[model samples]
Target: MSDPTTQLTVLFMPESAHGPTNQCIGIGKVLLDRGHKVVFAAERSWEGKLAPLGFVEALVDLAPPDPGATDEAAGQFWIDFINETSPEFRKPTLEQLASFVQPTYQALIDGARYAEPQLKAIIEEHRPDVLVEDNVVAFPALVTSGAPFVRIVSCNPLEIRGPGIAPVFSGYAAADPSGWEPFLAEFDRTHQETWEAFNAWVQEQGAPPLPARDFVHTSEVANLYVFPEELDYTDARPLGATWHRMDSSLRETDAEWEMPDSFAARPEGAALIYLSLGSLGGADIELLQRLIDVLGTTEHRVVVSMGPRADEIRLTANMVGDAIVPQTKIIPQVDLVITHGGNNTTTESLHFGKPMIVLPLFWDQYDNAQRVDETGYGVRLSTYGFTDDELLGAVERLLADTELRARAAATGEAIRSRGGLRVGADVIERVGLDHVRGRG
Candidate 1:
């Protein structure tokens, strides 16, 4: 319990994207409602989103080659690259993946450099008692600011590193003991190159050296995983003492949405499939059209969130495409979700006991898709080399499978029993207050 006499000021710094931004807002709302002062530091454009939440906002300027570029650009680049190589998986060699991620890495380094002074100014001005950071690109700035902070793992469980676990980017399911050696070797080689480059950049920026690891892991008073433990690689590999697995940090909004008139009047027996490719994945017009064409033939009512490219696509009577939709509101009404397997969408679907057909494109989406299949709650489809028949078949199979829905319901119950939002807030308040009191 918090002391009534003391009100802690908390600052949240999340990378400028929907997933990370939403996670921060979920926790920040809890903190604000509990009588503490909450602030958010992100790109200037996000101020509109943050303003409605009533939190004090601080905007940071990311450095050049693109001055004032937001963190969303990194994901946009990945989307553009995927589209350029569409209809076929560009399985870049390890060296090529390293080269591909370099510009994004440099952008992070530059952002951190620019953010250091901005964070220092905020710290000096607000004198926040604790900093809550979405573990994306702000670690260097947090460490240099000398502020006690908590790291939130909004993506995969890459922190639990060891020999038996599969590499995050490989999209491979957890392997048997004998089968993991080769994957481990490749994991080490790939990350070694990445860390060498990142650490070199850190030195150039005059920040403290980041510890070398197979993936980005930071030392913190408490590291919160905003995902169920069931999605983790394997129970055999223990998450060490410092880690805490919390329920999904999805904030429930009071705003309500009704189904589109066309969707509402669809045949009663038809299955409802909510198809979203996330903010980044929806950029591929060709891929979106292909998916729309394939799903249109099924006896399902398809609702697509086309993001920025919604106007470019044509829809049929069986399909409804919108530039944006209240996904949280719609996920519950749908029978099945066809998605890019993003962490936010994956967890939300699990929370509502909805089965999914996961079509992963890049990053941890592949890892999330693998877990969905491994957990028996969904089926995984390859984003590349899949025909209309394959896409239609997977959807038909998932919608018709009774056992999959049962598994999804069981997992959803387990997650809700853990006390979703309260579990996360309790950890944050206890650890954050302790650190402020110098008892951590």
Candidate 2:
């Protein structure tokens, strides 16, 4: 049973197109069902995904006008567009509460103003005892600037963990925190700038500047890792704050969700390898062509989630086939995943005990790949000068090495036995209650 002392209100934002937005929603649902008051500060586009999940209140339209349908395809085009047109838009748009990107800052401020009246009303109406928020929108930083509430930072694996965890990048190690001080400093610096910028915006609206990342280090701010604990990640041991592992609502197989009959005819008993560059940026055509050339002849049956962007690439005679589904569903069935090393996707693969071959393109992908490489659980390959041989070599190594497979499986088993949901629930309850007790 939940504690009677404190009521929690969570502000969630799913910012990026390929981001782990649903994971945030799933965590919110778990809290909401437990009788906490939760509110999501998200994009209008996420409305359809959130409405069914029982979120009645939201501070909506946190992004620009839908990038239009032209940006609907998540692949090389988007990556090229981001690089060509606007490089800073990717992380800042998602991470910053008030971005420095010109009109973007103005747009967010305006959006905040539009959302503030409604958000203020909800906060006043609900009188939440605590607030949990994604670091993306900095809603916690904005709304509870001086208010008293436990602030929990919600994020996927790489964003939250120490070095060598979930392969987001390579310098941090789980066993040793001091080893990655430089990277940690950089991470803190990035957050500091983001918060300072956000504080400037808040001050512009006549609100006081709150503390920086140091606030998070204190008991008042807690860190909650949202990926399933069953995943073999680096430095998963939670520190002073609580840790919550979210269960993927994705069932192994659902009768309603349909795939092509030709693709789904029968399970290929061989080691099932799933390939998805994720929904964000990737060299769709080149990577797809390379995969087709290599995996087509392999002993493993490959299933590719083309992610709508690179659907045109046809598999050669060697590959079994491919399908397009959320990786949450696909990773469970596959034996290994070849990905662009997005933290969420990597964690999903590890959650299911599947080994991975990380081909990072940009942002946190390289970081995630580095973690995988350093840990010996997987190999990280460069896509910058990728060739068919390089792709084939990585795939072959993952398939041939029994030790890596066993290690990955062992890690997965350890995570499964840890009671992911229960631990997470306990953390949430404890932290939320602690906030109330502090008031007393």
- What is the overall TM-score of model 1 with all chains considered together? 0.89
- Residue-level lDDT tens digits of model 2 in 21-74: 555555566677787766665655554556666775465544345454442443
lDDT of 1: 0.72
Model 2 TM: 0.71
RMSD list, candidates in order:
3.3, 6.2
lDDT of each: 0.72, 0.55
For model 1, the superposed segments whose C-alpha errors exceed 4 Å read 65-89, 92-96, 176-194, 200-208, 214-217
Query: Where does model 2 exceed 4 Å of error?
Result: 1-11, 14-18, 32-38, 57-59, 63-127, 140-196, 203-221, 226-238, 241-270, 317-324, 433-440
TM-score of each: 0.89, 0.71
lDDT string for model 1 (263-343, tens) is: 777776688889898876788777778888887777678888886667788776687768778888888888899898888
In model 1, which residue pairs have backbone atoms overlapping below 3 Å? none
